[model samples]
Target: MSKLEHAELVDGVREELITYLQNGTVNKQAVARTLDITELGIDEIDRLKRIHFCLSSDVVDFIETLQGRLRRIKTANQRDREITRGEVRGGIDWQATTRVRYTESAGDRTRFACKTPYTEYDIGENLVLKKLLWLVHSTVQEDISDINYDWRREAWPTERIAMFDRIYARNVHLNRIRDGEDIRVTRRMLNTARTARQSLYTDAYRLYDRYRRLLAGKYEDEDVSQLLSNTLVIPERLPRLFELFCIFQLLRCLSSRGLRLQPIESGAKQLAILESDQYTVDIYHDQNGGLSFHVPLSELEGIEADYIDRYQNVQRRHGELVDAFLGNDTQPSLFSGRPDLVLEVYESRAREVLTAVVLGEIKYSDNQQTFTRGLEELLKYIEFAQYEEYLSDLDIDIQGLIISDGVETNRDSPLDGEVTHISASDLISVGYPESWIPTQIR
Candidate 1:
């Protein structure tokens, strides 16, 4: 298959796998049917199932750890508040008589209108516990929803069912707090709830342990043993994880270069600002960098009318790179293409001047074909930026780079001259140099 075709196949498989893992009902049969329809061989399907189990197991482990930590969190001292009601009484609030009403017929009767207050223990730890419980509940529910396997049959071990039930009950009890169920009225009841947290963790641990033991035991078929082994491999999540990993790595590099990195607080975009004493860099992801341009209609007199028309048509159709040339508007065109990452450099001191803009693409796959396709795409973006006169008019040089797992590139490749292909690790280790910022643009 061609590289593009293979990438599409990988993406399709990933979506199916994600859907299967998130399904609340563990419907393995459904997933098997889907895989069969895709024409994946039995072996391939089995491998994918094993990977699903491994990732799901990791999630279970995470919840187990979180619950354990919740159990260990030191309980806070309980505070008591005086409250008064009919029949139940505590210390009197002499200053507040609104709750007291005297009846003429039942004058001076203690039962009729007694000013009293009772101390109710308020355990602050319950709030923490409730929040932690909610986290556990939500995490489990999400994981369960992803599961495409049905566990109604005896095929699923009894222990798993029991463990899930215990956790679900805990979630329900905590959820009831919003519905007037008090979790901290009495000391004994509060203590019991605290202990239940530990018990839940223990039950979950044992359930996972049982699975591990079962997998460890020798099976009649070697293939079955291999397939059921505890080892888990998930390539589907790698690309996104790699992207995040790069973001943080770049953050660290920029920090090392005496720049303070702050995430932009705008809801419309996910971007970060790297500020130094004299300069700033705006990191944009999957957005147009919030730029627009205005050009004088007369500028089209020099350029071909058809070419200008085509450019304007393309700009309107894509809403990406806007018209950067020939206009009083200082902003560049909204870039038509959304790269994985974009860095816009500026001089922060005195006058805020845009120095350069860098576009980047990330490819996590080690496959040569995938790397080539990504490189081509990166080159195309660079070409658009370079050939577009409007982009040049912005007075900022445009550069592009591809971050990928190590891949060999041809020396004569067009990308070799304009775009840099750097391993993700190396890029993180060595900070991106200022030289990469085109001096000519400044």
Candidate 2:
């Protein structure tokens, strides 16, 4: 093929990628399945490890809620501790106290062996929680060099990793649980835990059972398989993967700010909902949500009109772009070709009113033409699509941002202040403003 034909072919491929990504198919799990952990860099491996841990939502909830559930797991009256002072600390075993005295036949009268029964904690079933905590803590605290996939580490960012350190610290509930022969767990012991008759212990027992099962490498969940199975790797051949990676990086950064991943319904195509009590960011992969494609939009209330609108209805209309695309007979989503990602940011506290929107078009190409084409689409989106800040306070504004996987070219737009592009790698490390989010919550 000639250069013109080659360029056209390449452009055709880029267009198809948007459709594939937008069709509810390119989610975290799907993207994860395409990952080859061995081929990734150390930081990227750590990044995957973090996302992998989260892919198992059950596991995330289990870890976060486990300690709180350990209530019914009170100290048991365990009776087999050895006392060093000949005096019986709990009960005297004359045999134990005197046998050692007699066996040595040395004049060591100060040392006495006694049978001590203590109630501080038990090593039978009660110790299972400690053992579980120890297992997770040790795995998380391992040096990156020691990562051999024996267990996947939850390498949270610095502060959060320190937070995990505190939660996993043995001293938080009792002495640090050290691994040893004494910490051994048997099948009988696990069975005893699972069969606990008390309702109060139900959650605790269930969590412990999962902990034991997970540690044993019996991952019955497909999410866990995606995380641990070496063969279920992301090959380089997967298209538009960098787009997903860029989004994951954004999610990770938002996560560092107390935003959490909300569970999507089974078979749901939503990429994710990064939410906090104050805000909700619903991210869609390569679908028309804001303007053309499908958006899993939540019905919201409390839409007070632009408070100023009560005085004067100053209206704004997206002009030229509207003239180009809008028609009375047209039906869209109703379907238009999907944008790479449609992020609907909402003020969840205000009846989940939309506050901001991020209409994104990802181009996994260094080709100037490809980059320019994607950038033009985004600029056009800004022209026709206007998401208002409906709080009646902040002025509605429109801006654009590009997040990429290290493709460098001039992205300056002559029509506006900026259609600034950012490297995906930097997004992982830095913070961004709410204004950079073009569409606002209604």
TM-score for each of the candidates: 0.46, 0.38
Residue 329 lDDT, candidate 2, scale 0-100: 38
The lDDT per prediction is 0.46, 0.50
Q: Write the per-residue lDDT of candidate 2 for residues 322-394, one digit (tens) a residue.
A: 5568742322221124567777766773534565556677665555676678788776665545343222234
- Could you tell me the TM-score of candidate 2? 0.38
User: Which candidate wins on TM-score?
Assistant: 1
Candidate 2 lDDT (Cα, whole model)? 0.50
Best by lDDT: 2
Q: Which window of ten consecutive residues has the lowest lDDT sum in model 1? A: 19-28
Query: What RMSD does model 1 have?
Result: 14.9
Off by over 4 Å in 2: 1-229, 236-238, 293-335, 349-352, 386-399, 409-418, 428-442
Tens-place lDDT digits, model 1, residues 1-442: 1122324334333432333233311133323332332123322333444333433544355444543354344334333344333553544444332334343322332333334433222233344344334434443344333443443112223454356546546643333343222332344444444455555433433333333332443223333333333222222344544554454456556666677755334242434566777777776655446332233344444566787777656545443333334333322242335567777777873425666777778887667888878877776565555323545556666776677765655531243345666665465345433334444222
Worst lDDT run of 10 residues, candidate 2, spans 293-302
Please identify model 1 stretches exceeding 4 Å from their true place: 1-135, 138-235, 266-270, 291-336, 349-352, 386-389, 410-417, 428-442
